[model samples]
Target: MVSKRLFQSVAEQIAELIDEGAYPPGTRLPGERELAEKLGVSRVTIREAEIALQAVGRLEIKTGSGVYVSERKPASLGALPQASAFEVTEARLMIEAESAALAAHNITDEAIDELETLVNQMSSDDEGVANAADERFHLTIAQASNNAAMVHTIQSLWQMREQIPEVKATYEAVCVHDAKSRTDEHRAIFDALRARDPGAARQAMREHFQRLLESMLEATERKALEEVQLRASQSRERFLAAAKFG
Candidate 1:
C-alpha cells in the first residue's frame, strides 16, 4: 500500500517528469483513475499529489477540463517554505492567546453554544469530522473576539498551514495522536470564556499551544528515528545481497 509520504514523492516525480517534457505545458495529464493505476497508488493519493503540485505551480486544474501541466514552474522544488508544526503552534500561541482573551470579553451565548457543538464534533472518532470541527472551533473563537482583523489573520494563518504540504502532513499525523487531548484543551478554553475570565482564557490558550509544541517536537523526533531505522535496514539488505552474490 502507498503511504502518505508516497503522495508527496509522487508529486515530486510528476513535477520532475513535467520538467523533462513528459507532459508539456498545457497538456492534460492522465485522469485521476488512470494516474492511480499507473502510479500504483489510490486515487485519493493521486488527488493529494495533484493538489500539492498545483499548490507549487507545477500543475493547473481547470473546471470541467482535465488537470494540465503548468507553463511556468516554481524557481525550485523548495520554493514553498516548509513550516514545522512547532512554528505553526508558536504563531497560534501568539495570535490565539489574545483572541481567546478578547473572546472571553465579547463572546455571545449563541457563539458559546456553537463552540460547544464544535467541541462535541471534535471529540468524535471520525478523524475527518474531528479535524474540520477543530478548525471551525478556532475560527469561531477568532470570530467571537469581534475583531475582523483577528478573524482574517487567523484564517490566513490556517490557509498558509494548509498550503505547505509538509506542515499539513505533520499536523494530520499529530491530530491522529493528540485528538482527545486537543479536544480537552478546547473545552478548557471554552470554560474560561464561559466564566468571562480573560486571564484564564489566555492562559488556557497558551497551555494548549504549549502541549502542541511538545507533541510536535516528539513527532519530529519520531520521524527522525524512523528515517534512521529505514536507512539502517536498507544498508543491511544491501550488505546481505552483496554477500550472497560474492
Candidate 2:
C-alpha cells in the first residue's frame, strides 16, 4: 500500500510533468491504466490524486480524453525556479516576509547607514543602476537577518532581481502610479526595520507584497485574455473582409 505522503509525492511529480510543458496546457494526460503502470501505483491511488489536483485548478477533466492540464500551473512545476509567473510571485512574497522579520529584529544603525547609502545611490534616473540598487537594498535587509542561509539565497534572488526590470517596465507601460507605490512600500519596510518591531516589519512587508502580487497576477491574466480577444476580433474582421472581396 502506498503511504499518503508517497501518494502525494507522486501526484506532485505528475503535476510537475504537466507544468514543464511535458504535458502542456489543455493536453490530456495518459489514461489511468498507463499512469498507474508507469508510476507503479494502483488505479485507485491515481484516481484520488487526480481528484486532489483537479480540485486545485491544475487539471481539467475532459470527458473522454483524460485529464487536461489547465492554464494555471500547479506547484508541481518544480522548486519554483522553473515555476510559472504566479508561483514565482508567491514564493517571493513568502521569503520576503521572513526577511523583513529578520531585518526588524536584527537591523542596526550600521545596516541603516548602509541602506541609506544604497538608497542615496539609487537612481530611477538611471534605470539600470536603480534596479541594481533596489536589489542591493533588499539583500542588505536579508543579510541583517544574520542568517547565512538567508544571505546565501543570493543565487535565487539574482534571478528575481533580474526579472524586476522587465516586470517594472511592463507595469510602467500600463500605469503611472507604480513607481510611487514601490517607493512608498520600500520606505515602510525601512521604517519598520528601524523600529526593531519584528511584527510590524513583517506585516508591512507582507501587505506591501500582497498588493503588488495581486496587481501582477490580475494584470498578467487580464492582459493575456485581452490579447487573445483582440486577436480573435482581428481574425473575424479579416474573414468578413475576405468574404466581401471574394
- In terms of lDDT, which candidate is strongest? 1
Evaluate all candidate structures by whole-model CA lDDT and list the values in order.
0.80, 0.66
User: For candidate 1, lDDT tens digit of each residue in 104-207?
Assistant: 99888877887888788888886655765677678778868888678656765675677667788778888789988999999999899889899999999999
**RMSD in Å for all candidates:** 11.2, 18.1
- Candidate 2 on 1-246: residue-level lDDT in tens? 624444466679788887677888878888889999988976656755664465455775433245778776443322324444455556667887898798777777878876766565453665444444566577677767877566545325444433345543444443344655666677777788878888988888888778877777677788899999999999999999999999
Q: TM-score of every model?
A: 0.66, 0.58
Per-prediction tally of clashes: 0, 1
- Highest TM-score: which candidate? 1
Q: Would you list the clashing residue pairs of candidate 2?
A: 16-76
Query: Could you tell me the lDDT of residue 62 within candidate 2?
Result: 37
The CA lDDT at 78 in model 1 is 35
Clashes of 2: 1
Model 1 CA deviation exceeding 4 Å by range: 1-82
TM accuracy, model 1: 0.66
Which pairs clash in model 1? none
